[model samples]
Target chain A: MANQDFVGIPSQVDTRALNRGASDFQRLRRGLLFNYLILGAGAILMIVPFIWMISTSFKPQAETVSFPPRLFPINPTISNYIDVFDRANMGRLYWNTTFISVIKTVFNIYTSALLGYIFGKFVFRGRDVIFYILLSTWIIPFEVYLIPLYLMTVQVGLANTYTALIVPEIFTIYAMFMFRQFMYTIPTELIDAARIDGAGEWYIFHRIIIPLSKAALFTLIAFYFMWNWNDFLWPLVVIADQDKYVITVGLATFVGEYWSQYGVIMAGASLAIIPILALFIAVQRFIIEGVVLTGLKG
Target chain B: MIQTIAQKFTGRRSTLRAAEHRFIVIALVPTIIFYAIVKFYPIFFSFFISMHEWSLFGNVSPYVGFDNYALLAKDSLFYKVMWNTMYRTFAGTFLGAFCSLIVALILNPIKRGSILLRLIYFLPVMTSVIASATIWKWMLQTRFGLLNQLLSYVGIQPVAWLQSTTWAMPSIIVMGIWGGIGFTVIIYLAGLKGIPKDYYEAAEIDGASSIQLALKITLPLLKPVVSFVLITGVIGGFSGGFQAIYMMTGGGPLDSTRVLALHIYDYAFQRMFMGQASSMSFVLFAIVLILTLVQFKLQRVDWEL
Candidate 1:
C-alpha cells in the first residue's frame, strides 16, 4: 500500500513529473558538456599569449619577427636570457625590484595587521569614524597623490631611493580591510582570555593574532609583492637613476636597448613572470577566495 | 542631587575607560603616522603645487592659481585625452566584465578541470603587465604579425591595429580585456562558488528553465559582485590602464591613445607643466569620486551579497 501510494502521488502531482526528472538529468548533462567546452576554449585563449611569449623568447631574431609566425621556437636558445643579464644588468634590476617588493610587503603586512587589530578588537573613542576615514582613502586614486608625493619625496631627499616606494605603500586600506574582516571572524573572547592571562596588548597581537591570521597575512603578502614588483609609474617618477630601476623599468628600457630584437625582450619578460606565477600556483586557494570576497565587499 | 551623586560614584569606571582609550590610541599610532605621511600630506601638497608653476629642476617659479586650471579647460588635447580615457574605461570595463562573467558561468558547472581552468584564466593576472603587453604588441603588428597571419587564413586583409587612429583605442581595449579578463573570471568564479546549490534545485522543482534561473536568481544574487567589479573596473580602467597604453603605444600615432593619466605623465615629466598636470590629476579624482558615489547609490536599491 505504501509503495502504491508513492507512485500514485508522483503521477498525480503532474502528468509529466517523471518526464521532468528525465529532462532535468538531460539538462545537467548538457550543462556539463557546455561547461567543459567553454572551459577548454577559455583555457586555450588565456594561455596562448603566455606560450607565445615563452616560444618567441627562445626564437632567433629573424624567426621572432618572421611573418606567418612560427608556433614554436624551431631552434630554442637561451642567448636572449643571457643577453638580458650581460647587456642590461638584469641582476641589479632584480635586486632593486626584490628590495622594494619585499620591504613593502613586510611593512604593509605588519602595519595593516596592527591597525586591523585595533579596529577589530578595541572599543576606542571615535573608532568607527576613524575606520571610515581610512576606508575613504581607498577612493583617492594614486594619480591624485602622485604630484605631491613626488614633491615630498624630493624635499625629503628620498627621491631615487627605495624609501620613497616602501614608505608610501605601507598603509593600504584594502589590506587593512582584509585583515579586519578576518579579525572580526575571530572570537573576541579569545582576546579577552589573552588579556586576562596577563598578556599585554602587543603580546596578544604578536602571539594570538598574527599566528592565527597566517592565511590573510599570506594573501596580503602575495598581493603587495605582486603590486610592487610590477609597479612602474612611481618608480619611474621617483627613482630616476639607471642603476635603481626595477625589473619593470629595466624590461621597458631593455626593449629600447634591443629595439630590433623581440626575442631578448620576450626572454626577459618570461624571467620576470616566473616568480609571480610560482607564487600564484602555491597560494592560489587563499588568493582566489580572498580576491572574490574582497572584490565583492570592497 | 541624586543624579550628581550617582555620576560621582561611577567616576572610577570612566577612569578605566580613559585608560583603555589611551592603550587603543597608542596601538594606532603607527597607522596614523603612515596615513599622514603617505596619503594626506601628498594630497594637500598636490593641491598646493597645482597652484604654482614648477619644474623638475628644483624651481617653484610662481603661484599662478586658477591660471593653470583655466588653461586646462581651454586645452584641446585635454578634452581629447579625457574622451579617450572615457572610451578606454567603458570599453575595457564592459567587455572584460561581460566576457569574464559569461566564461566563468559556463566554467562553474564543470566538476572536472575547474582548478586547472581557473589557473589558466588567472595566469595573465599573475603575469606582469609589461611582460604580457610587450608580447601582445608584437602580435598586433600590422605586417608580418601573428594576428594578421591568422586573419589571412580567413581570407581577410590585415588591418593596422595600433597605428590607425580608428583602431588604436579599440586595439588597446582589446588587449586590456585580454590581460584583464582573467582577474575578473577568477573573481566571478569565487562569487559563483559562494552561491548555494539549493537555489538551483528549488528553481528546478518550480519548473523554471535554466536561462530563467540564471536571470531571475543568479544575476540578482550576483549584483554585489557586479557592482564591485564595475567600480574597480572603472577605477582600474582610469588609473592602471596607463601601463599597457604607455608600453604599447606611448599614446602614439598622433596621440590617439593619450589617456588622462598618460596626459598627466607627459605634462609633468615631458613638458614640465606641473600645475596643469596636477589640475588634471584632480579632475580625474573628481570623476572617480562622482562615478563611485553614483554606483554606491544605485547598488543600495537591492543590496545583494
Candidate 2:
C-alpha cells in the first residue's frame, strides 16, 4: 500500500470553500492558521535538540552547565572541537567510517543490482527458489546471528580488522530486494535489443542495465552509506583498535570517556551528525521519493 | 570460443542460452555460497550455541539442552527485562504512531512550505540514533539538563529523568517518539496520499464537518497503513533500541531500561554469556516471527520486503 509520498495538497479545502458560503471560507482560513501554529511549534520541538547541540558545541565548559540553561553561550570556544579531534582521533574515525561505508555500500549496491537483475530480468532454473531463500533471511533479526557471527569472525582471524567490518556484510538482503523491485521497471526489450545488437551478456548488464538503474542506484547508495557510516555494534565488537574505529563506535567511547565534558562531547556529537545530515539534505528529494519507491519506512 | 560454439551445437544449447546460463551460475553460485556461509549457517550456529553453556573464552561448553532458555524462565531479572521490552515497544510504537498520524494528517493539506516543514521534522530521523541519544542524554541530565531547567521555570520540581527507574523508561519512550515521529509521519503522509480526495469532498458536500470527514472517510481508508505502521513498528521495536539504550542508560538506574536486544548484547559481549544471550535472541526471533506473520495476514505485504 504505497503511493507518491508528496501529492499536491488535498483539494477538499478548496472544494469546500467553493461549494459553501463565506463563513465556511473564513472557518477554513482560521483552521489553516491553527494548523500552521501547531506545525510551527512542533517543528521547533523537532529541531531544538539540534540547535541546542550546535549551541552547546560552541559554548565554553562553564556555560554548558550554566543556570537558566543558556541558549547562547556567553563565551564561545573552538577548543572542544579541537579536543574531539586530538583526543578521540576524530579525523581517523571519519576516514575509517567513510572508507568502510563506501566499500560496504558499493559492495551492497553493486552485488544487489547484479543479483537483482539476474533474479528479476533473467529467468533460469531455481532462480525464484534461490531468491526467496535469500530473501527469507531478511526477517531474521541480526541479534539471532550476532553471537555466532562474532565467533566466526574470530575463528577466521578477521577480528580487529576492517575486513571483519565489511566482508560479512558485502551482500545485503534489503538493498538487493529493492534492486530486484527496481528491476521490474527496466524493460526486457532493452536487454534483448542489446543481445540482438551483439552486446555480450555481462556487457549488457554493465553498460546498459547498470546505467539504466541510476534512479535506484542513487537512493540505495545514500541510504546504505548512511546506515554503514552509523553502524556501531559490529565495529564495537570486532574492531578493538581505536585507529580502526568507525565514527559511531569512536563517538560512543568518546562520550563515555568525556561524559562530564559537556561542550567537548557536544562538539564530538555535532561533528559526527553534521556530515551525514548534510549529505542527506543535499540529495533529500531522491531519498524521500526512494522511501516511496522502496517502502523503506526508516 | 570455437570449442564453446561446437559444444553449444552438440549439446543443443543456443549460444545466448549458454551465455545466460553462465551469467546466472556466475551470479547465483556466489550468492548461494555467501548466504549459506554468512546467513543460513550463522543462524544454525547461533541456535547450536544456545543449546550449550558457551563462552568464547571458555574451551569447554557443556551442552545444556534448553537449560539457557529455562534459565530465562526462572530468572526474575529476565522477566523484568521482558516487561521493560514490552513497555518500551508498545508505548513507543503507539505513541509514536499516534503523534506521527496527527502530524501527517495536519501536514497533508498544507499548500505552503510543506517541504521545509517535512525536512525539519526529518532532521532527527537522519541523525544517527547513537548521536541523537547522546544529545538526548545531555538534555535529560538530572540537574544541568535542559528539560529540568525548563521544568524549573514552570515551577515544577527537577526530576531525575534517566536516573530514576520510574521516569527512565518513559523518558526513553518519549525520546524514541521524538527521534522517530518524522519517519512515521512520512509513512503516514504516504498513506494519506493513497486516500482519494473524492471521498472527503463527498463527505463535505453531505454537510459532514472536517472532524467528521476525518473520522469517517480518512480514518477508515487509512486503516491498512495504520496497521502497517503498528505491525512494523512493533516488529522493529523487538530488535531495536540497542543503540539508544546503550548510550543513554546502559540498561540501568535499575535494569528498568533493559530491553531484550540490549540484554542480548550485554550478556554475549559484556558478560561473556554467549549461550544465554543466544537463547534470548531466539526468544526475540520467535516474537518477531509471530508479529511478522500477523503483518502478512493483516496486509497484502506484496513487494514490501
Compare the candidates by TM-score and give the number of the best one.
Answer: 2
**Which pairs clash in the backbone of model 1?**
none
Docking class of 2: acceptable
| RMSD vs true structure, all candidates | 9.7, 5.5
C-alpha TM-score for every candidate: 0.88, 0.91
lDDT of 2 by residue, A85-182 (tens): 99999989989989999999999989999998988898777878888899888788888988999999999989999898898899988777877877
TM-score of predicted structure 2: 0.91
**10 residues in a row with least lDDT, candidate 1 chain B:** B296-305
Please give the lDDT score at residue B30 for candidate 2: 88
Model 1 Cα lDDT, one tens digit per residue, B145-171: 678888999998999998999998998
Query: In candidate 1, how many Å is residue A60 off?
Result: 1.1
